[model samples]
Every structure is written in structure tokens, then in C-alpha cells.
Target: MVDRPIIFSAAMVRALLAGRKTQTRRLATSPLRRVEVGDRLYVRESMHLWSAGHDAEVTFAADDRSFQTGPNTGDIPDASLTAYFRMVDQSRAKGRRISRPSIHMPRWASRLTLIVEGVKVEPLQSITSRDAISEGIERAGGEWRCYDSSGTGCLGARESFCTLWSSLHEAPGQRWQDNPNVVALSFRVEHGNIDTLYPNLRSARA
Candidate 1:
């Protein structure tokens, strides 16, 4: 019954939101190795925030939308939108937008939570087709497929999973062919701020 932070790309976040993703595999690093069944993982995605004192608003890159913090209006007001853009403009003037990296996102701003249901340690390439599908491969025209980092689609769940994994892990010993040991996590996505749904469990640890 521990809570930890996990980072996901915008595409994976969308898949989780759509109920298409249920499993994830990460290198059996010290941090991931600590995860266990019954643990809660708060997702960290790319986002930006505009705040003034206790007032704050968050815009997620996943869907390019804004959400008001602690409130009724799901959409930011015209005035606030203006200010948000103005802030963005200021950032652009220096050469970038206000987008924050997923790794740096605070837990309080996370919008997706995953409840771990199972955990296993296995070789990265040992992922079965069924498990690959659970990793968020999509079916189109009756073919299970998934896109690599370059957006090229690989046909078949296992094939697609291999491509996806290779694209993300190119280190000498972490690539697909390396057959590195990985922590495979099976989880159910819970859509909401983690703290909002499990205030009592927020401080829990394994």
C-alpha cells in the first residue's frame, strides 16, 4: 500500500485515460524494483501551470486542455486564458513554451493514478502477445498494432511491443535484444488526482 510516481508520455496517458492500457514494463532499476502489488502509482505527464497565490490552473499536454484547480469551472475563463497565453508568450520570447517535463511534475498535479494489481520480474522480451495488448497496442482493420517513437506502426502486438521497447531503451544493456530483466506491472487506471481519491493512503509505504 505504497504510493509512487510514474512518468508517461502523452500518448500513453491518452491510452490509460481511454482504458486501453493496463500494463507497463520498466527496467528492473532500484526504483521500479521497489514497486509491489497493492501499490498506487501517480502518473506524471507533461503539463504547465499558471498560478497566483492560492489560485492555480493546469494545462496538460496530453489533450491540450486546461483545468481549474479546486473548482467548478472545467474551463479557464477568457481573462485567465489571456494571462495563460501571455505567460506562454513570455516563455517563447526566451525560446520555449511553459511546458514542464513529465519527470519534474509534482505528484499533486498528476491526473491519473494506477492501482497495481500484479507485479512480476522477467526478461524484457518475454512479454506475451496478450501482455503486449495490455500494454496499449491498438487494433485497426483487425490487426493489432502500435507506433514506435518515430510514429511508424508495427503490425502484431508482440512486434509492436518490441519496436516500442527498443525505441525507448537504447542503452547498451537495456535494449530489447539485451533481454534485460524488467519489472512488469499490471495495474488498473484510476482517473483523478491521486490525493483526492486516496488522502489517507497518500502517506502509506510498502
Candidate 2:
């Protein structure tokens, strides 16, 4: 599995989003839809802010997944791709369907698990769990306690890996709603699978 970075200028990101077929009108609290690089269109979340300064958000329809044409380095006007070693679900919107993106990958490449570390999260299975999210908490050296909800098809199933990130010693209250940082997790899946799952974090330079 090769690892690389996919960097997007603020402007190019908007052009990509503008090309998407789904109307970018709604700002519902949902995970940003996955957009394929070089294939699908994309728009940055920051571009949608009005006077109230809504949260930065972007969305791509599942249809764009098949259009992924790989990463870009020369400022391609079309949607560009970034090869990465990890992918994180930054759109922590609760109650949305968590389906796989439509990228052009083999069947074996579809199976992946994200190991988020260095934060606190609560398992979405707690009574306070939300319908849209399989929540988890990140705490103490990448350790996470996740809540597996019925939507995840892992509710009460110990084999499930659904979890949410939370703060240390904050108890199991609904405090995650106040977190401002984008949701990020550590990577430990198959080498090739890492970037596909979290291109943003994997491409980010330290």
C-alpha cells in the first residue's frame, strides 16, 4: 500500500464541490458525503457560511465515489485525489446513514477498521446514544469506549467497533455536542486501506 498526501487549496476545494450533482443547499447535521478525487465535484464547508457563520461543512453524493481518478499535485481544476495512509470521519453528524462511499476499490479493499487514539469517546450504545451516530469516546493513549447503536447493526454486539471520542474525566454526559475540533482518529488498518478511510488526516503534514 502506498502512502501520500492530497492537498487542496481553499478555492479548488470549492470548485470540486460545485460540480457535485447533489444540491448543496441543506446544512443538516450529517457527515459530509464522500467525494472521489479527479472524478467527482466537491465544495469546502467554509464556503457555505452565511452571516451567522454556520459550521464549516461539505457534502458529496455517493454517486461521486466511482469518479475517483486518483490524487492531484498540479492544481487540476477538476476534483483531485490525494493518496493517504489514513481516513477519519471528521463529519461527526449524528443520525445519518453510515454507508460506504462509492470509490473504485476491490471487494477486499472495502473491509476496514479505524483505530482512533489520543482522545476520549463514549460508546454510542449508551442510553444517550443518537440514532445517526455510532458514537465512541477517545481517552488515554488512543483508547476509546464506543457506543454501538442499532443503526450500526452492532448494538449489544461486543464484536462491533463503533465508538465515539470524548474528553477525559468528563463523565458520560452529552458533552460531545460542545466539542469543536473535527473528529479525528488514529490508523491501524491494512496499509492500503488507511488512506482510503482517512485521506484528510493521513495527508496532513506534521
Candidate 3:
């Protein structure tokens, strides 16, 4: 029951939060090459975006020299106790680098955890309409002919997903055709903090 950290772009995170995305496809050769039932994935959003909650207040500094973090009513921790930057910085600063960056993200940084329910491997172009909806596409109430822009009606589920994927990975050797096989992992969002998966609580429930 190890906790594996998986970094997701902000768009994908939003889809997950909205329950529109339940499956993700990965290159067969990537670190996430294989998955099994019961594996848990800790989903981390982009490190750059910081959003405010209903009770949380955000303030910007007039001068670029200083900044305010939050509006917590509780006592604040001493600034001297913490070093602000990420751990990876130290290695990069010394001219060294970590090869597999995704696996190195700290567990505490992940806000959501999902339990894998199924796994499969197939060609990249095998997405079905049902699966496309699972991948977060809304039915445009007709097929969009990519060649013409005459407001050709709705795009099919597969074509819609292709558009989304192409937007994210547009580089020449990284397009859809370049990826022959993909490992698809289907998961369900867990109800609480990811911490529950690392301990005796899961065993107790079992």
C-alpha cells in the first residue's frame, strides 16, 4: 500500500474535481508503464497555481519585495524555521539533476487521492464514445470537420478527445500517432485525505 505521487496539469485536476475525468492514459514506456487493481494515485496539481478558499483571503503586495501568505487567525509559525524553496532546487543549484521528476514530488503536496479500479493496454486510437465522455468531453449538440470551419456541427467523442489531447501535447514526435500503445488506468476519487491510504485505517476497514 505505498503512496505514489502523480503530478497533473491544472486542467486535468479541474476535470477530476468535477468528476468528469475518471481515466488517464500514459505512454507504455513511461514510468507509469503498468498498473494493477487497488493501486492508489495521489494527484498533485501544478506547483505554480495557488487558489483561495471561501474562508481564505488573498492579498497582493504593492511592492514586489514582500508578500502576505494568508489570513489565518491562528498564530503564525516563525519565518526563520522554514526554507521556502523546493528541495529539487538544491540539486539543480549544484548543477545536478533528477532524471524522473514526477516520482519525486512530496506526498504532502498532493491534494487528492484516487484508487485504481481497473487497468488495460491498447492502441492509442481505440477510444470509444463512452470512454471519451469519461475523459471529460461534452457532447456538442454534430461532427466538426477539421478541414473546414463552416461551423460544422458537433464532434464525435473520439474526435473531441483527440482535440483535447492534441492541445496538451502538440510537439512533433509527441503527437497521438507517435504513441503506439497506452496504459489506461481507471480510478475512483477517495473521499478523504490521502493519508488514510498509508496506514492501519485501510487494513481496519478491510
What lDDT score goes with residue 149 in model 3? 38
Per-residue lDDT over 46-123 for candidate 1, one digit per residue giving the tens place of the 0 to 100 score: 998665543456789999777665333333333234544555455546654366899987666678889999999999
**Candidate No. with top lDDT:** 1
Clashes of 1: 0
TM-scores of the candidates in the order shown: 0.80, 0.17, 0.62
Better by lDDT, candidate 3 or 2: 3
For all candidates in order, the CA lDDT equals 0.77, 0.25, 0.55
For candidate 3, give the lDDT of residue 68.
26
Q: Per-residue CA lDDT of candidate 3, range 21-135, in tens?
A: 8998876776666456887777754332122331221111111121223334221122311321233344345544322233343443344688888888887788787887787
User: What is the lDDT for 93 in model 2?
Assistant: 36
Q: Which pairs in model 3 have colliding backbones?
A: 142-153, 142-154
Which sequence of candidate numbers ranks them by TM-score, best first? 1, 3, 2
Better of 1 and 3 by TM-score: 1
Clashes of 2: 48
